[model samples]
Structures are given as structure tokens and as C-alpha cells.
Target: MTEQDPQIVYVVDDDAAMRDSIAELVDSVGMRAETYPSAQAFLDVCKPRHPCCLVLDVRMPGMSGLTLLERLQTQGAPIPVILLTSHGDVPMAVDSMKGGAFDFVQKPYREQALLDCIQAALSLDRDRQNQRETGHRLDQCVSTLTSRERDVFDQMLAGSTSKEIARALDISPRTAEVHRRNVLRKFKVHSTKALIALFAPAPAATQRAS
Candidate 1:
């Protein structure tokens, strides 16, 4: 990626040497790398706008990597995090995954393995960004609907037929059909099935819940 539109890889470790080394590795792969000596230092800076992921040391001086991960989650930040841990810390790292970390790598990690993990984290962040953008667009479309049309929209989503909607709304079937058509037009979908698909919860979210 070019400098103007580069993906960012943030490296946060209390150890200066390790932090610098991880930054260098990320930079070598053509992504923009920003280094911080502590988790708080990383949080002090403004959040990155471009697609990004975090490479965090599991043990830090002030704010531990797990604490930072929890803070990010509480704030609803979408950036994926890959924790760096020692061999003995594997159990904690696995727990971190359950806590929303993208992944973790053991210290003395293979260079290629860490790089691969970072790439996957970046991909996940991109998917999250896209989902948010699409949701915003759908919300805008919904906002454009008239009150009666919105009622029709909800009914359509609930799998209501024109006759059923007419009875519920105390309107004629022909009038209900007209509102339904208007709702479809506003959503830019040819069919109710397509509109339902657009508003459906993402597959990843469903999987996580299951």
C-alpha cells in the first residue's frame, strides 16, 4: 500500500528491542508500523483511521496486554489484536482469544508465523470495517422511509403478505402492496428476501453466538 492509504500495524511492548524488532518486521512487509513502549502509550495516541491490527506483548509494565485488550473491547474498537507471549503463557493467551484477541504468538516466535498472524488480523479488521459501513448505509436507507412505509418495511421483514399487512394496518391490500413497493425501492432491493439478507446479522456474529 502507498503511504497515503497504507494499512497500519501497531507494535506495543515494554521491551524497546522487541518493540523495534516487531516494527521492523511489519515495515519490511510494506505496512506502516507504529511502535509504543507500553500499552498506555499506544492508547494515548489518536486511533488509526486506516485498516490496522495490534501486536501486543502479553506482559507489560503498567497496563498488561490483556487489560488493554479488554479496554478496547469495552470501547467497541474493531481493531484486531495479536498478543506476544512466552511459552509458559500459552494458557493465558488462549484465554485472550476468548476475550476477543485475534490471535497470539509465543515468544521466540517464527518470523513467518508472526507475519502470517498479522496479515490475518488485518483481514479481520477490514471485514469489520466493511460490515460497519454497510450497516450505516442500510440505516440511512431506513431513515428515508415515511412512517407508514416503515411499518410496511417491518411487516415485510416479518414475512407478512400484503393481505396480512393490510389487516394489521387497517388498510386495503392494494394500499399495503403500494407501501411495500415503496419500501423495496427505498432499500434498493428487488425482493423482500434480498432486503432481509441485507439486514441479516453477519455470519461471523451468528457463529460466535452459537
Candidate 2:
């Protein structure tokens, strides 16, 4: 198995002791962590990166954790965030979940439970990173297709047979078959089903007019 980069866990809280304790707990589990005294502090230093998640205190002196979460969402940043809350803050934390927080841990939390939440957040980040890389690769593959091949691929995806594709593109049926084979080869998919699975989001309008 390839070794993954260490997961970075950001701890943003107003209480210095809470930050220290959370950072220590995270470090004990072999993950990297950084402590921020306030949400603004986290925002000032946060350069978004993959395989990372945030542990944010719900109540902070400046820019509450929930506000920070809202900012992150507005910016379209993909980092997973786990909220930390006191007993009285459970209602707010529940609202944060509805707003896209991965999970929340109540204060006086079980160390094991927090660690499990961190692991889950890290897994989400990894899965998202993998999906982005796959999409980039697929885009590169599509870029390699010739115009005629793209036409054939799109027509095939739109449920057109080889003969229909030929009629649509004003090409011979054999030529349409050749283009179809090239499309499959370029995409590294053996069948139309596999091709569609990979590129289903591609627009149907890409098919040539008959």
C-alpha cells in the first residue's frame, strides 16, 4: 500500500488549554495538528489543502466556529470540518451538521470518540481527493479524442447505433465503428456501459445533428 501524507487536524478554539489538550490528543494518534486561538486565527493561516480536517470550537471570542464553517462553505473549500461544542451548545452543533459539518463532539468528550471522528473526516477528505484526481484524468482522456471520435462517442452515448452515428455524421458505418472503437480505447473502457459510467455527465447535446 502506498503511504499517504499525514492527516493534518486543525484545532480552532478560544481556550488555550482546550487547544493544547486537543492538539496533544491528535498528536498521540500520529496525526499532525495545529492550534488556533480563534476562528480568525484559523482563517488567517488556513491555506486549504487535501487530507485535512478542522476541529473547531463552537463558541469562540471572535468569528465563532459556525461562522467560520459558513465562510468555508461559501468559498467552496472542500476540507471536512468537525465541530467542538459544550453541553449547552448541542443545539447549535446540530444546526452546524445541517449546514455540512462532518460531525460534532461535545466538551468533556471521550478521547476515543474524538479520534474516531477525526479518522472519519480524514477518510472523507481522501475520498474527495481521489474523486478530483479521477475527474482530472478523465478530462485529459477526453482532450485526446479527435473531433470525429468525440462525435461518434457522444452519439453512441446518446443511444445511437453505429448506422445511426454514420447517418448523423455523414460517414460510412464502418468509419463510425472505427471512431467508436477509438473512443473506447482512448477512454480505456471496453464497453459502452463502462464509457457511460465514466462520462455520463457529458452533455447529450454533444451528439451531431442528423
Candidate 3:
């Protein structure tokens, strides 16, 4: 899907009334909704690129909701899941959470409560997708660096001054400074701190270097 496409709320419930009601609730908030009569219907069209989450019913005719969640876990990127079940199904809901369900709601839930949960799930999915995209971009940027440039980049991340880097790399201080500038330009960061922030969750050694 295009980057500008609306995030989808996928509703999977064998009960037609429940599916339509959930679809209506999702649509009220301006998000797109795709309803399925069973878990298999959802599995058939769940694409990796879709920014969506599952509003799954705990009990269904053939493949149950938990089964669907387990199957999806092995397929590709994990989709946020919110289980809908009756009050008596509380134990199953707890079990579903351990299996990676985002949240669960009891039957007779307020429309607003369900809507809020769905919105939260959609936001979580969006953030996850954004992080993946950012990581891909970072890899692409790293790929453009030459071996010498890469070495200089690592040294800079290690917090070496130009003079020190020159000694370490057997290059002149002037050359080290040039490489530093190139590294900054390539990373699109104005300063070392900004670079470090962009490369957050850096190694302990890298943090010490910074």
C-alpha cells in the first residue's frame, strides 16, 4: 500500500453482528475496516505491508482466534492483536496476552472503550513500521560509505579527536578532519551528539566513545 493509505482495522468474527458493529466503530474514527467471517479469511489476505491490526474473536467455528494469532506469529511481521471475548472467556484472554495479544475486551464493552483500544493498536503498529523503515534507511546510508570512510566513521563514533584519529589511522590531522566532515555529511547530522542520538541504543563502547 502507498504510504498515505489509511491504516486498517481488521475485524474477524463469525458473528455477523459483531463484525458489522466493530466495523462501524472503526469507521467512525476515519480508519478503514475490513471484516472477515473467520480466521482463515483474514489469513488469506493479511499482507505484510498493510498497516493494520486484528480485532479477533476468541471463539470461532473452524480455526480459533488463538490459532490465528499463533499462525501469524510465524508468517512475517507481527500484527497487533486485540481479542474480543465474553466475560466467561477471561481466562482465555489472559492466555492470549501471553501469546502476544495486544489487549482484550469483554463482551458488552462500550463503543468508546473498544474504539480506544483499536486506536492504540493502530498507533503501535504505525510506530513499529516507522522504526523498521528508519532502520532500513540507516542501512542504506551505511552501505554508501567506502571502507576508509567506514573506518573513519567508526573512529569518530569511538570519540577520537582528529589528531588522535590521524595517529590511529596513519593519516594527517587535516585528512582526519576531512573524513570527519564527510561522515557528518553522510549521516546528515550537524554534530556528534546529534549523530549519537540518531544511532540510539548504540553499543556500550560506542557510548563511551561518544
lDDT of 3 by residue, 1-210 (tens): 246868888889999998999888888878899899999988887664457888899999999998998888877557888888898888888877877788888887789888888777877777677777778888887898888889888887777888988999999999988988888898898886776677786332100000
Candidate 2 lDDT by residue in tens digits, 1-210: 124677899999888998899999999989999888998988887786668899998887779899999999998887788888888988888777878788889888799989988888887777777767889998898899998888998897887888999999999999999999999999888987888888665332111111
Which rank order by lDDT, best down to worst?
A: 1, 2, 3
Runs in model 1 deviating more than 4 A are: 1-5, 205-210
Candidate 3 residue pairs that clash = none
**Model 2: residue 11 alpha-carbon error in angstroms:** 0.9
Deviation in Å, model 3, residue 29 alpha carbon: 1.5
Error of 3 at 34 (Å): 0.3
TM-score: model 2 vs. ground truth: 0.87
Candidate 2, residue 119: how far the Cα is off, in Å: 1.2
Q: Please tell me which predicted candidate would have the highest lDDT against the true structure.
A: 1
TM-score of each: 0.87, 0.87, 0.89
- The TM-score between candidate 3 and the true structure equals 0.89
Residue pairs of candidate 2 with colliding backbone atoms: none
Regions more than 4 Å wrong, model 3: 1-4, 202-210
What's model 3's lDDT at 135?
85
Q: In candidate 1, where is summed lDDT lowest over 10 consecutive residues? A: 201-210
lDDT of 1 by residue, 1-210 (tens): 223557889899999899888888888888889898888898999486658988899998899999999999999887788889998888998887888888889888789999988877777777777788899999999999999999999999998999999999999999999999999998889998998899888868311110
